[model samples]
Target: MNAIIVTGGDIDLSLLESYISKNKYTIVISVDAAVKKLEETGKLPNVMVGDFDTLADEKRLEYYAGLGIEIVRHNPVKDFSDTELAIDWAYKRNITEIVIFGALGRRFDHTFANILMLRKYKKLGVDITVVDRCNRIYVKSNPFILEKRLVWGKYISFFAVKEKVFIESLTGVAYPVENKYLDNIENPSLFISNEIVDDYMSVIFDGEILVVESRD
Candidate 1:
């Protein structure tokens, strides 16, 4: 089953609503301030996990408790971020796919850290993705097919998360490549700003690559 974790960051309400309505997420978790935002949408999370430092309303907490929502509290002094804790909780349940919302915000540090969390849990065998209004961010180390043309995010870009990443093949893109190498040592400008020219696209790569499918 898949799980969606709502985190404490800037969220695009329209996108959030679109995802919740169209996707059959098995479970939904709210982290700290996200609980209030999720509730504002007239929907309740299945679970709430966080230190609760940012959640100020005492009555609202009581209301959630009364509804029998599972609340997992953590010490504010802990090492992992609230979103990480929530992901760990889902991992413990043997969830194989997780989509994170509200991961991007005005705070660049937190946004960067959240993106790195994808690397930290890369070996957990879960397909994790961080989504916002204009972007879908994820890490890849193998071949995958972009099966359909995205309606929102039109441009696809790839960055080498490792020192070097060898792409076996890139097709169905405006600027296609065959057995290309995207290494930090070389000029890494070739892989950015690619657009889908066909019904689908495919990328096969070696090593870790960070993919951002986005639009203006």
Candidate 2:
């Protein structure tokens, strides 16, 4: 089943609307306060997962239930964050290719944590991505291709999540670099902001690579 995940980050309604309009999916999982954003967009998520710490009042919780939204509650002190729980729930349901929204443009720690969660899910063999108005982020451990689209972000950064990533080729970008090693924990900027120039671009990595396609 196709699914979309919304996390508790500052959301861009325009981007969210456009994304949902293009896809026909059975579920949209809202993590934490992201459920409110989904409601503001006039779209109710099929399932909502969070601790509800941010829900100021019981009435707000009732409002969600009144909409027939399935709410999954967790202890605020749990080990996994709300976003991780939502992701796990999706995985268990055999949902493939989850597009995560509202995971960027928020607290730096949350943003970083969510990105790491994306990497973790990469091991589970699910195609996951985090999207916002200006960027689309994902992690890859193997070769992947991106078709020519105008760069959404002013810059594109790639960091080695594993040990090393060997970039095979790049095109249609401003600072195109090919066959380069994106070493982990050291010299992380080697693959930052390499633009695209042609109809397509490709990368072959020996280890995991976190691709952050961002705009200014």
Candidate 3:
């Protein structure tokens, strides 16, 4: 029902393992250096996607090849990043739900780009989420249901990903808003630090916005 893509970024192994155990048939993908982490953790990925530059060990490469995992190598000089390639591969396979790990790290530019990729995948009708130890990030352009159990904490924030966003309404939350208008270019603090009160929270937006469910 979902695909887990691990990139060459800082990740929490315990959290990653919990996600892997949640789905029965989760397609696991490793990108470059992440392959080493997966192999070390005894969670061999089903597919490997990247330029192979970050994957320096030849023996490990051969080992995965022997295991018959799908390896998609691209040129290091390519246009798109390795994570984007992995996302595209999952999109082509008709995998609607994709959970990406190890995508948030020291490289601020890479993290920002990966976050923006959420918009592209959302437009393709694919539900993609970037998950790390402290936060779960996604882009929402339509109404979405958020189970309280799934929220990282009581704190959830909605920020306009685009220049402007039309918020239809927010329900079942502590600081509920009705028919709110948010424009990042004009005022970036329109919606900030909202809390969920009920068992579930519903977010309805007419335009694209970044939703961050985070915990301290």
Model 2 alpha-carbon drift over 4 Å, by segment: 150-154, 168-178
* TM-score against truth, every candidate: 0.94, 0.89, 0.93
Worst 10 residues of 1 by lDDT: 145-154
Instruction: At residue 177, give the lDDT of candidate 3.
Output: 81
| Residue 163 lDDT, candidate 1, scale 0-100 | 73
lDDT of 3 at 181: 81
- What is the lDDT, from 0 to 100, of the residue 94 in candidate 2? 91
- lDDT tens readout by residue for model 1, 1-216: 889999988998777887898999999999987987787777789999998989966687788889999989888899988988999999899887899999999888889998988877777887789998888999887888895556347789888887778888899999999887898779577788898888989888888998998888
Q: TM-score of predicted model 1?
A: 0.94
Best-to-worst order by TM-score is 1, 3, 2
Of candidate 2, the 10-residue stretch with the lowest lDDT total is 147-156
Runs with alpha carbons beyond 4 Å of true place in candidate 1? none
Ranking under lDDT, best-scoring first? 1, 3, 2
Q: Per-residue lDDT for 1-216 in model 3, tens only?
A: 678899988988877777787666468999988987776666989999998898877687788889899888889999999999999999998988898998899999999999989999999988888999888998887788989987886589889877888888899898888887888877797677788889989888887889999888
TM-score of 2: 0.89
Residue-level error in angstroms, candidate 2, position 87: 0.9
- Scored by lDDT, model 1 comes in at 0.87
lDDT of 2 by residue, 6-106 (tens): 88887888778777888887799998788778877788899989898886567887888888988889999999878889999999999868999977775
